[model samples]
Target chain A: MIEVAGLTKRFGPTLAVSDVSFEVQKGEVLGFLGPNGAGKTTTMRVITGYLSPSEGRVRVAGYDVVEEPLEAKRRTGYLPEAPPVYPDMTVVEYLAFVARIKGVPRREIQTRIEEVSEKCAVTDVTDRQIGKLSKGYRQRVGLAQALIHNPEVLILDEPTAGLDPKQIIETRELIRGLAGQHTIVLSTHILPEVSKTCERVLVINQGKIVASGTPQELTHRLQGYETVLLTAEGPAAEMMERLQRVSGVNLVEPRDAADSRVTFEVHAEKGHDVRAELARAIVESRWKLLELKTSGLSLEDIFLQLTTKDLGEGPDTSDKSSVVGIV
Target chain B: MRNVIAVAGKELRAYFHSPIAYLVMTVYAALLGFFFYSFTATYVVQSFRIQAMGGGMGAPPMSLNEYIIRPLLAGVLTVVILLLVPLITMRLYAEEKRSGTIELLLTSPLTDLEVILGKFLGAMALYAVLVAMTFLYVGYLFLHGNPNAKPLLAQVLGLLLYGAALLALGMWFSTFTKNQIVAGVVAFAVFLLLFVMDWVTAYGSGRASDVISYLSLTKHFDNFAKGVIDLSDVVFYVSVVVLGIFLTARSVDALKGRA
Candidate 1:
């Protein structure tokens, strides 16, 4: 329920977001991945009507943010990178103040506050001063304030930053549960956050979106260049020769071994799955299979591959391939 | 309007929660009490003695303010009124920016006016409390001697007008910086300059001195304290309030990037 077109933001001479465009459909949890300073927060600000885009338009729930600010704001909830908080106000008071400012119906404000607090699980500390809250609780309070009005579109900037591992996991689950009721656009540098929490991923580099697709599609596209390792109780020389004989096996080489068990690493031809063929050959050779390892690329690998500048350019782009070289 | 009141209520509550309000109250009561006892009370006792000696007292010292109090105390109320006003007003938009809570407030459906008026009215309510306590001196002034009701009315009105001007100036200063210290210092500086303008103009050998004195807040506010309903003085305070509120709204818009 959100649309952004030709969106650009310039802070003086610096272009923070450049010609960015994307849509998050109703009920879709879109993960926005970018390195630090990649313009994600700028984009989120533009969409939320907090910062008017230097050019183009952003519409949320059918209302253009610039042309109809209040209506657009009425339909959207946004949590900026810093959990906007007043240290002197307690959590309940803070939520109530936010509810009133956000134009929630006066009569329903208390109920709305309770609803969001329960949903974000910030109810227990509703009476505590926000400044006294731990980082995680403060964050949950921020989420509660954003969701108090139950806006249709939610734009969260790094919703799970600076938390212990368990808290991070819990926050992700909470965001995931918010899907379907609220169209979400969440930005983070965490790769697995995208894989676990987003149905579709949008990879941003510098100030531009470099790629967008399902997680499986990204991995499948990069699967063209992959390899497998197979160790078996067979002659290294003959096993390597036979594996090379199999169609779609591109390269074969011996790996260090123990006793009669020898190892060989094999590269597959483009679009090839050589597992069945390799297994068949080992059974025929009467070679006892000791170990078979397939190169299963993690989301980190996919992120590195797409974010790696050289691979994106077919090696003609600037060398950010060191990103890929690591891990 | 709901947003404004909501904000105003919170700000009023904030004043009580912080010790600064109590501190301002203590200082305000002490200074006003000094003026009440030394000037208003002595004037009333003398007027009564003069009337006892068969002389006609001016207007029979009707309200507690007549013999002992004048609207000028109300005008100078702007001085101490200003002391507390800037500390809170400086934090209006400045604290929000410093704490990054401006994003939360502005990003909501609240309009700029709501934010501005809410904060203004909130500060006004606290100033109202300070003004309320100062009235106790008026009560005491009326108890012993005849006091004029009319001048007392003018003084109360003058207190409000002075408050409106200073509050506006203070709120406007708040918009200039994110640092509360800077905001408070700058606001205090602006008032200090205005407070000293008449003196500087008196010393210098140019019509510029006359011009500075004319622009000085003290000059515009002087008529109010003297029980004179000068429209120009009213206009001047109104202008100050408008200017302060206008600049504050613009600042919030600029920071919100809607400007």
Candidate 2:
């Protein structure tokens, strides 16, 4: 229900968001994964009609955000990085004000407030002033404000930034429950949040969309070769040599050895599964197999690799060619 | 219109929820009351002195409107409003920008005009309340003295318009910065300049001198103080009010681009 095309936002001479384009379909939960200062908030602000794009255009629910801002804004709900709340007002009072501005009918405002308060789990603090609430409650209140209008599109910038672990889980569950009814575009620096709650992920860095895919696809696409970790109580030098002889085994690197126990990272050719062959080879060699597991690239490693490549810093061991395909 | 009211209602609530509304009202009432007492005492003393002269000399008649209500509304209240209006209008946009609530208003479906007008009206409402307190003192005059109700009404109208023009200008200054203190200081400085702008006419006489005196905020109120509602005075205050609101709308619009 949202489309951003060639959206470039410039603050003075510095570009906050540059030539970025993405689409989120109806009822689809898209995770905007980026480290801090990755233009995630800037892009969301453009989509929500808070900040006009310096170049290009953004449309929400078929209304151009720049040309028909009121219509676009009517259908979009935004929760900025800092919750846009009046600290002096009570939670209920704040929600009621948001409901009014969002154009909820007078009679329906009460019901809508109660519904969102319950959904965001902020029902208990309804009567208390927002300034007195805990950070977690305030964040939830922000979430409730965004959901008050029940808009078709929800743009949340760092929705789970300040919540405790339990509160974070509850918020994720709440967002997951909102999937089919509302199109959500939530930005976060937390990698696991994307894998747990989002159907698709857009990884952004330095005002650019670095990568976009499902959690599994991102991992698989970035890792061009299969890798296996085998730990055995044997001589480290001999085990590395034996594993290197297995068919399809492209390379083997020893990781750690202590008290005659050894760890080896075995690399296999693409599309090859060398686990069975390596296991059989270890058994025939009379070495006791302690642990054997295939190790695919996790999202964390992929994120670090993707974000660190541009900085020309961090570990650069991965083949650069494999990453160029996804971008 | 509904959106405007909603924003204005929120602005009003913000003012009341904080200590600003009560503090300003109490301080303004105290100052105005003190001025009223001193002005009334002086008027009473002057009347007695004029009567003691036995109406023989060519001394002018001591009218209550001329001696008390005119200066109270036109001079004392104008200065009082000058001192207090920045307190009311400084927080209109500055606090919203400071606390990040501007995002909520800007991203909402409401137009920039609606938000600006709502804040304008909200500040005007509080100013009205401050002006309304003078009625408590003014009402007392009717019971004891034969003050001209026509001049009193005219002066009150003039005070509201005068305060409205300043409030609008203060609100416009508030849109420039996120710091309320800075907004208040700048607004007060500009108001002081406008208040004293006519003073420059004493030094020279030319087209520039006439323009400066005409632009002086207090000069236009002189007509209303004399019980005459000059159309030119009305138009001047209205123009300033409109200009202030228009500039505020543009500032808020530019904020979106820079935000």
Candidate 3:
């Protein structure tokens, strides 16, 4: 339902969105994952017809954003990062206004407002001024406004931002409930939100698509080195040295152990499970085996590796360097 | 037309609820009262002398209700409009961008022209309502003085035309900057230039002087103040308003692309 081709946006010497292209089929939730300045919001704005692209075109539901903006917008609903709201207006009034602008039929406006408010779980605060609502409720109101018209395409930018853990789960459930009914392209800096709510992932970096695949596909593609943790009652350094000397054991580092017990993190080469070897060696050495477990990397590690831009063997530490203090 | 009315209705209602609008209305009513009372005092004191000398101030050929009061009103109200219109219209688009509401409005199916026109109409409607509430002064003048009614009617029409032009200029000025304070100062600066164009022209030589004078807003406004009601003056103000709206629409479109 959405197709973007060679979309480029430039402001003087700064290129906000480069030559990026992607497609989102109907009834699919595509997660756009990136760091702070990854141009995901810029691309979404171009598709929503809020910003014009310097080159190329974006089409939604078979209509060009620039050439047929009204029609394209008619089929699309957008929730910007801030959730544009008026302090004085009640939730219902705000949603009604949005419906009016979206050209919802006058007779059906109230029903549409009710439906969206219920779907977004904002029905309780429908009569209260939006300015008086909590952040979570305010976000739900924003989502309600976007879903009021029942558009086929929804583009939400950071929908779960600033919400509590419970609110985030509720929002994810709401989005999941919307699956197969609309094509959604959601952008977020939070990798876990994508892992939980989206089926497909599009990773963008510095105005370019660095990777795109399902969560499992990406994890499996990058799942070459297997990690295992071994806990034993033995000399920590000696056990680490022994494990490191093993043929399939790529690296071994000693971790903390209490009560004369030693813990080591062992990384095995591809297509090898060094767990059995470590267990047999520990039995032969009369070392007591405490615990053995496989260590799996999270989407966080995958994100860090894909976006670190440099091929390296050490644990990625760049996530801390990208912190921008709120001034 | 539906979009225009929907957007305009919401904006017009917002003006009523905003503190700035009420503050401006209070100040305006006070200024009107001050000027009206001051004009009455001056008329009574000055006309007394003329009447004693057989000039027949009482029951004279023209009453205080005549068109002479229009100029003083034109001057006072023009200054008042110069201050208030910028405040009312500056938030039309600038505040939207600052508050991120512009994104919501722009992402909708409405065209740039629709947003500009809706805001323009809304601002003008609120201004007109403010102007309309001044009808108490009309009733007061009519009851107290047997003024000639023709010129009063002409002057009212002239005020509407001149006021429309100024509102449009103010709306256009608001679109250029994100800061309302900057929008206000810039709008007043723009008005000041047009307000003082005649002075700048006076010091110059040749037809440039005449051209500047003709282009001055005050110059066209004066015809309305004097109850002249010339078509050229009316057309000139209307053209100014149209030009301002056109520029505003173009700027909105340009901003969406560049900003």
Candidate 4:
């Protein structure tokens, strides 16, 4: 229900978003995965009609964001990075105000507020001033305001940020519950939030889309060939040569050798699993097989490889670097 | 229209919930009350002295409208509103910008004109309430003495237009920055400049001075205070109000780009 084409936003000297293009279909949940300053929020702002694109155009529900902003905005709900709330207003008052501006019918306003507050789990604090609530509740109130109008398109930026682990899980479940009803484009740095909640993922870096696919598709695409680690008691050079000759094996390199025991990393061609054949050959050749396991790339590795590898640097190999810190 | 009312209603509620409105009202009531009592006391003393002298030197008696009500409403209240209006309008948009609520408002379906007009109307409503409080003194004068209601009504209309123009100007400045202190100070400075435009023209009466006097905010109120509602003066106040609202709308639109 949303189409953003050639959107470029220039803030004086820095280009916050440049030539970005993407489309989100109706009832599809698209996860926007990017590190901080990856133009995720900028793109969201453009789509929500908060910021006009310096170039190109955005259309929401078939209405141009710049030309027909009111119509476009009427059909879209946006939760900015910071929940835009008045500290002095109570939860119910704030939601009612949002509903009013969102063009929710007056007669249905009360029911709509109740429904969203229930959905977002903010009903308990309806009478309390928003400033008095905890961060989790305040964030839920923010979500409640966004959903108050029941807009067809929902754009949320970092919906789970700053929440406790339990709150994060609850929010993820809430967003998942919204699937197939509202077209959603949620930007987040958390990896599992995407894997657990999104149907498709778009990885953006440095104001450009680096990768776009399903979670499984991204992992499989990044794993161009299957890798198997084999530990055996054999001469390193001969074993490496014999392992390469095995069917479906593309490359065999000796990883380490100590006395008679050596380990070889076998890379099988894409779409091939030659573990059974390689194990039989190793046994038939009279080499003592100590360990053999298939190693497939995880989404974390794929995300790192796609975002950071293109910077002319291999993935950082430190213990802390193994975690997905960027996206 | 509903969008405008929605925004305006929220803003009006915000003003009432905060202590600033009450604080301004108290200070205004005390100052205006003191001015009214003192001006009437001075008028009464002069009247008694004239009666004691048996209408000495053929001096005509001073009308309460000329000597007391006109100065109280036009002179003293103008200054009171000058000091209080910035306080009323400083947070209209600046608070939204500081707290990041501008995002929600801008992203909503409301147009820039609707948002600006809503804020304008909200600020006007508060100013109206504050100005309305002074009418109690007017009501007392009507009950105790013979006072012409025509000029009184004219002055009330004049003050409404005058105060609205100032409120709109203050609202426009509030939209230019996220700092309320800056907005208030700059709005006061601009209001002060416009307030003194007539005085500045006193030094000379050239074409430039004539233009300055014509542009003076206080200049147009003089005719209304005298119970003469000239269309030009009405048009002038309306023009300023329109100018202020238009600039504020443009500023709100500008905020989206800066966002």
lDDT of 4 at A126: 99
lDDT of 4 by residue, B32-84 (tens): 99999999999899999998978856876678888889999998998988899
For model 2, the DockQ equals 0.70
In model 4 chain A, where is the ten-residue run with the lowest total lDDT? Answer: A317-326
Expressed as tens digits, the lDDT of each residue in B116-209 for candidate 1 is 8988999888888887886687776567555676767766777777787888889888887889889888888888777767887766867787
Give me the displacement of residue B115 in model 1, in angstroms.
Answer: 1.0
Q: Please tell me the TM-score of chain B in candidate 4 relative to the true structure's chain B.
A: 0.95
Best by TM-score: 2
What's the lDDT for residue A204 in model 1?
Answer: 82
Candidate 3, A122-159: lDDT as tens digits: 98899999889999998989889889889999999999
Q: Tens digit of lDDT per residue, candidate 1, span A9-66?
A: 8888888888888888899999899888989988898888778888878989999988
- Residue B70 of model 4, lDDT score: 94
Q: Give RMSD (Å) of candidate 3 vs. truth.
A: 4.1
Instruction: Rank the models by TM-score, top first.
Output: 2, 3, 4, 1
Across residues B1-259, which tens digit of lDDT does each residue of candidate 2 receive?
Answer: 9989998898888889999999999988898889889989998887788788787278756788887788888889898889899999999999999999999999999999999999999999988999999989888888898788998888989999999999999999999999999999999999999999999899989999999999999999999999899999999999999999999999998987994
Candidate 3: where are CA atoms >4 Å away? A255-262, A310-327, B57-62, B65-68
TM for every model, in the order presented, reads: 0.85, 0.94, 0.93, 0.88
Model 4 per-residue lDDT tens digits across residues A1-327: 999889899888899988888889999999999889989999999999988899988999999999999999999989988899999999999999999989999999999999999999998899999999999999999999888889899999999999999999999999999989999999998888888989999898788887787888777656667889999987677777778889999778787889999988888887898998888888888888899999877777676766675575644332223323323
Candidate 4 docking quality: incorrect, acceptable, medium or high: medium
- Each candidate's B-chain TM-score, in sequence, is 0.85, 0.95, 0.92, 0.95
Candidate 2 overall lDDT versus native = 0.90
